[model samples]
Target: MKKVSKAIINFDDYVERKNTDSRKWSMAGMHEMATYVDDNSIPLWVADMDYKVPTIIIEKLKKRVEHGVFGYSIPSEEYYNSIKYWNKIRNNWEIEKEWIVSTPGVVVGLNFAIKAFTAIGDGIIIQNPVYPPFKSSILNNNRVIVDNSLIDKNGLYFIDFEDLEKKASNPKNKLMIICNPHNPIGKVWTKEDLEKIGEICFRNNVILISDEIHSDLILFGNKFTTIGILNENIINNSIICTSPSKTFNIAGIPVSNIIISNEKLRMEYLNEIIKSGLKPIPSLFGAIAVESCYTLDGLEWLEEVKRNLENNYIYLKDYLKENIPKITCGHLEGTYLAWLDFKKLGYSNQVLNEKLEKEAKLVIDPGEIFGEMGTGFIRLNFACHKKILIETLERLKIVFGK
Candidate 1:
């Protein structure tokens, strides 16, 4: 692997993604009102980035494709080692090989955790204005949704622990899914926060499922502490879902590693996957992509990506504050997503979304989808080239400044 300097990593270089069946682009379709937008519409909706994948991973994929025999493939020992090494080096968290369970995706692993830990009709607690899938995974598995919605004050988000404790106290509330370096709101939870939540869950007999998928994307010098590292009790009772997809822009390649330190919990989750009729092995390309993404070259690429993301956030925040004062953006501690409060504008979700689509010709994730708390807000993906983000903001000024 070649070492590339930050100066050489061209995050500003635009890569055309239109008509590529991209969920962030062409595939968003009529359901998202994307079909009605013009061809030049700026899409800042999906969690995935508009940037290209790191060159190292792409080269590795090309070589794998050249082999041309895509047969049933199992994860290699190298794959497990790569994950172990990444956890140790990147997160300062030691993880053993046996503790890792390969899943097709984080969302799939979430469903497996829901099945393994909680029974049908059991309550699953989640912090709202969270990733939409957290709610879907619980409901789709016949589990009840118990929302411990975060408290928003002056554009910042904080976990409502009292509400969380009350929700967890319910005997039927068997599980809680935590989004570390939380999506949409982009709050990188602190050690203290994790410990408090862990204690609440431990005492209430609620199994904790920590979705640390965005763990690798800590922005603006914020540190991410995994719930597994909180304490012995937390580690014993928690399952962590991690992936290289979001960090490396390889989300299309399905791969996630579910980490469970407790032997009993690990086996139960594996059994649930087997019962679901889904093989535990990831796809051939998924294995290669994960391994490639944890290498030294990959780390270097990610450093550059993080810097670019930080710059993008700063640029967007300042631009909105100066030009579109009605829109308030919260401090982005992690993730490329920016949570923008539009309540001051006093527009309904329907009208706001329509104005964005028809007037500005832009597509962003409406906050209402995250939960009712997300009403009067919108989440913007600022992980594109700086030029594209500038254009999007200009469009926003045109639409909302009226």
Candidate 2:
């Protein structure tokens, strides 16, 4: 494990989103901002990080920008090969070249998968306290939502295999979406968990769509079990939607590769992606970001990010347990997000929002937005500089008014 260079990447070299109509920072202020209200809370609510994309990626993007033609660009083998090669090397999962399909983003691929396997009224099973988009994709596709909520023990969340088996075995359910190293709660599913889910879904004739967007972001001692490696049964039953977005902070580039080994399913998914025609630029920017993160400087930087997140998690855990003891939170094995339990505070979602807004002055994703299960659990993003994180915690401490 080599060290990632800590040299300060100049802020001036980075693109500032304050005025560019970016959804991340700008979404906080926009009148039509669907999720957040117009207020001044340092915008850490979204999944993107404040860290600069790897310098190699930046250089490649800059060189591509200079070309100026802006015509439709098609990437070479380097683009696709990097994805296949990276997954094979890092995950120990072998993906054939023909199995991979390019897409605008993982969420898009989810929609495509829904189209591929499910009818409009079919049911989709999702692990609750998950990435919110999973529900959106299911519902937006007019599919029924069958939530298999995770069991949170203290601050750790675990899958309830019995409950999962019961729900997945229901005949109405046609698809199961697994979030590897799930967002918000951040539990990296064990091989056993994956196998159990595979068995249940298969028994019920459910097609598995594993959203592995957070697969590469696990912490020390936690190995990601790519759904592809779970079993011959699950591999044949699943499609993996992955990308450089969360890991490399190039989400705006919005490129994801859907790797499906099942021949019939792969073709069906690709056909849907083409029919929807979502805007996938040559995304020279995304391609550059992927190559850089996959081949060169990313693994080390990821280690640094992992270390930083672990440190922050420890700091928050110690401080909150000692100081703001009333508020509870839970397992953070992957993703930059933390789900804090505010149920003990006894505030309704509306009142919690008001108190957090007026008192904490910290902008976090509201618990209610995640679903009934996420009620009273606020999601925090710890991907910023350490100093900013400390300040945010301090503000929250004051919100406790202790």
Candidate 3:
């Protein structure tokens, strides 16, 4: 792919987000326990990017807005074709039209999957520190959360496959949610790692739910292998939750593509959606956004975004090492979220939160919400202009640099 010129996409240009119903910029975006902040506070918490979405998507949406008739809508052939095109070109996976199920968001799809596949009191597995919603979805529906915690070897994280196998072997555990290019900690699972996970799920009668929302945000030469692209048997036994929302920074649009190749599982999932009275139909604008962003034209914008995110990560890592050596950040293999280790600061999670929010005036996702394993850490979203990232780093230095 050819490099995108700055003239085409000026990633460094700072865009104002405050007071625009922006979740990240609002005090409401923070945890209930967090300290209040004034206008000077910088929010690096939310997973959504601070940058504007691609011009191609903006133009497409504008055309639809001009139509001025907002009514009930269904997925178009163009929508399905766009999904197929993206997967084939990006992940090299060919998908059938019938296999695709449109969901409002990945979390919604997860809740429906849990309802469809497992009975009450059945166990659902997830690896943490991970996205917090994975645990909430299970408990909210009266299902069991069987945690297969990841091993933190130094700063880097690794899956505890042995523990996972034991959890899967148990008859009560009926499902497992694996985050590819995992959130909080930006570790992208290798093909071998995925194969092992798939084998465990296939053999144990556990339905695998692979959330690949961050697959397109891979950085620093890491590869993302979609679970659907694995062996035939594994593909039949798994569900892939994906979306262009994360890729193109249109997360507020609420669009996701949940792919299930197995006919029986797909039917069960659809049946659950119907029973719940929640139709999987995309909004007119949602359908247009997906169709617009999932094309070959969106590739240039994506590449440039990845590059900008990588540069931000590099800057954050280096700035910490030089200015505040007590804080350690792991290599960001994928995703724009940088997992920072602040245990060396000798502060409890409360103190850490206070220091960042109260003193530093930097609002970021405290690691504890991600799970117990994430305590003593922070998830900093780096998908912003360099100027914002620099200001964030300088704030950390002011508060934590003793």
Candidate 4:
């Protein structure tokens, strides 16, 4: 592994994502819309990083690609060991070999667990201004959503325990989805926070689904404690969804490590997966990516990535503060994402988002997409080179300059 300044990482050499029918890039090419801003803007909305994946992962993929054999596949014992090793090394929580059941992705695991644990109309709880997929997973699976809106104070995010407790105790609510080191807002819940959440869920009989996909992406100054490690009660109720995809810039690869410690949840979800009859072939190249990312050179590359995120976040914060004073992002504790609160700008969410897309030539995710509380906000992905970060911020300043 070579140590070099992340600023030297070239993003332009990265191939264009346009032709892949990427939702993050493609405007969907609707000819009927009067104003298609995606046509003009460079997208920073997607969660994927713009940096090149580590050389180790690239080499592993190359070896796999070189192999011409394409047949039904099974994850070897080493594959499962890789997942266990990652949890132990990065999360400080040793995973039982029996704990992990590979899934195609977290979204799929969420749906399966929802159906397996709770029936239709069972109330499911989630903190608001969270990852949009959490809400979608519940509703799309016919489970009711019980919003426990997080409290934001002075740019910091905290769990709304009063509200979460109320919802958790509700008889109709049977499941609560917890985003460990949450997305968009980037709050790495402390062990103390997880303690309260676990007790509340345990007492209320609410099944906890902990999405820890971003756990490994903790920024330089923060710590990410897995919810399952907080307490046995939480672990018993918890169905943890983790993947190398978000951490390794391989969402397109799509291999997820799904863990359910409780035998009941494990059995139920297993039944659902089989009933759904989804094929179980291993994602060969993706498997190689996960293996290399977790078992080899993961810690070293991870440290560099964390440094890159911290430096990028600081650059973004300084730029926005100096140029776009109205845009204030709260403390970003984990993940390379910044959640910008633009309420001071006095523009409707739609107007603000449109301005960014058109005038700024930047495709940012509007807060409204998260929920009503997200109306005055936008989620910015700063997981790119410093130069690109500077360009994105400068473009926004030019568009929103007073």
Output the lDDT of residue 366, model 3. Answer: 92
Residue 92, model 1: Cα distance from true site in angstroms: 0.8
Q: How close is candidate 1 to the true structure, as a TM-score?
A: 0.96
Predictions in order: lDDT: 0.87, 0.77, 0.89, 0.80
The numbered model that scores best in lDDT is 3
Candidate 2, residues 142-209, lDDT tens digits: the string is 99999898887777778888888888778888899888988778788888888888888877788888
Cα lDDT tens digits for candidate 4, 85-135: 878777778888777777788888888888888999999999888888888
| lDDT-best of 2 and 3 | 3
Output the lDDT of residue 232, model 3: 92
What TM-score does model 3 achieve against the real structure? 0.97
Our tally of clashes for model 2 stands at 1
TM-score of every candidate relative to the true structure:
0.96, 0.91, 0.97, 0.93
Q: Tens-digit lDDT track for model 3 on 305-339?
A: 88888888888988999999999997689999989
**Model 4 ranges off by over 4 Å:** 1-22, 27-35, 279-281
In candidate 3, clashing pairs total 0
| Pick by TM-score: 3 or 4, better one | 3
TM-score rank order: 3, 1, 4, 2
